[model samples]
Target: MAIISKLTIISILVISFALAFLAFYLISPLSKEQRKEQIGEIISQLINFVLFLWLAKILLNLQLFVQDPLAVLAYPSNSEAFYLATLFTGVLLFYKRRQKKITGVLLAHSFLQVFLAASFFYEFIQFVWRDNPFSFHYLIVFGVLLALFHLLQGRAKPQNQISIVLAVGAAGFFAINFMLPYLTLFGYIMEPWFLALLLAACFGLLIKDPQDEPHSETH
Candidate 1:
């Protein structure tokens, strides 16, 4: 019974994630082939992040992991692990881009859309099914991000849109996290340092010339 319940939960989560990706793919403005490739890359990046997160969680508690591996594995990942995972993933992304496996603009655009879509869906599910009070705040937050990104698509340069959105999102998160002591998304409270790093990364990406990006949009 326990095994079956775990399997069911995993299956539901997979389906929900697939639906989120599908929603982004359907509404994307990129060409069909471009959209497909971008979504594929997004999935690959997400997998990389998850794998790093798992590894970081184990490493964060070396003593516990050495004593009781099973118990350590069963425990939830902490904020420090989350930050380490994000840092490792960011490094991996930089390496991939250097290898010409990733394009700056396309990755930025695709990732933002998929992130917002998945976040909104997760918050909606939490609000409706779990009656989480924080979920409503997150839903409104993500909705505003979606609307802001859409508004920027027309007014802002394609190269600048992602940086602008990322900056704004990080700032918003910082404010919310400061005001709400129990700030959490997907059961992990974000550390301020992570948001600060995101802002720094956004600034770094902002300086790149879009023309140099392989998948850069001229329009």
Candidate 2:
């Protein structure tokens, strides 16, 4: 009975983690139409995920399990932070119908995607190097999330600048984090090579503005 209960608890935790990630992703839409469709789905999934997380945090971490308080605090804290960003992003995107703000949205998506990649990379580095635990955990707090909250208040602005190096870095990060043999189960970023190609394409789209061109818009 004890064994069964522990397994059940762990399973629940993993599921909540996955769902929370989905909620985080749902908040990042490339277009207005996509935002409308995605917003509700994301909100719904996030509510379910947060409820599950709160349950687990109270049960496994706070009340029953009696594990290390530090572990409990750290894990659940990170989990809670998942949607905090989208709160600001969603609000601003909701109010501003201007297509110009898409840059901010795209940048947020890129940075969040980088932070997530860096997180898993930190783990990987620890596994291989055993000495260096490279971390990008707070990138959310100091980086994208903070920037987004400002955007919510109309205080945020995005300059039209995309770096080729940053683009390559994004793609490289995706390949390693999501691709590689035996790692495809995560499949979060698709294949590394594919991600490399993908980042290149995303950069191309930002500058190309296919819809702005007469011939492209006609097609």
Candidate 3:
């Protein structure tokens, strides 16, 4: 049963990654260099998260891991691991962007759009396979936001528009989660931290100069 559960989770993650990749490929309008940089940063973050998860598991079961290093792989992740990974990834991304002299607002705008599209695809799949109404609700919301994003992409500066959309969408998502406690992923309660982060990013983007050219070409 444990092995089966592990394999199921792995399969789901694989499918999600594939869907996210396809979504990013289709929706992004960045130059090759910008795309490459964003993709590399994303992949690095994922790797860092996995490493953090492993470290967390090992620390939690030090004796067991010491006896058998492979045991760490079998350990289930807890909220601690996720929180740590989120913090680590956030700081790492900020540091790397600063080091590279990358504009924070531009990076946030691009990533938020990609994230919304990828999240929509992932939820759509879950809605189809699990028949979850919550997933369907989120899918609709994300789809609408994505449509709005694309519509405004060519006409307006994306930093402000995307930030506003993300802030609004995050508020809506929070409301839905509050009203529907049963909306969960894999029996784990979804945290509102993602929404908080989105709001923070939105505020950050809002303060940036609107006249500055974004890192990527929108058209």
The most accurate candidate by TM-score is 1
TM-score each candidate.
0.86, 0.28, 0.78
> Which should have the higher lDDT, number 1 or number 3?
1
Off by over 4 Å in 2: 1-168, 171-189, 208-219
Candidate with more favorable, higher lDDT: 2 or 3: 3
Assess the local accuracy of residue 20 in candidate 3 as a C-alpha lDDT between 0 and 100. 68
lDDT of 2 by residue, 1-219 (tens): 765755554564455345444544454433445444434444454465556555555554565346566555545333223333333344444444245534433443334433344334434433344442222322222234324333442222222323433443464455445433322212121345544554554455445343332110110
In every candidate, how many clashes are there?
0, 1, 0
Model 3 stretches with alpha carbons more than 4 Å out: 59-72, 182-188, 205-213
Q: Would you list the rank order by lDDT, best first?
A: 1, 3, 2
Candidate 1: give its CA RMSD in angstroms: 3.0
lDDT of 1: 0.75
Per-residue lDDT of 63 in model 1: 92
Give the per-residue lDDT digits (tens) of candidate 1, residues 78-186: 8888889988988988887777677776687778877887787777777887677777877888888888888886577656778777777876787788667766766
Candidate 2 residue pairs in clash (backbone atoms < 3 Å): 175-192
Find the 10 residues in a row with the least total lDDT in model 2: 210-219
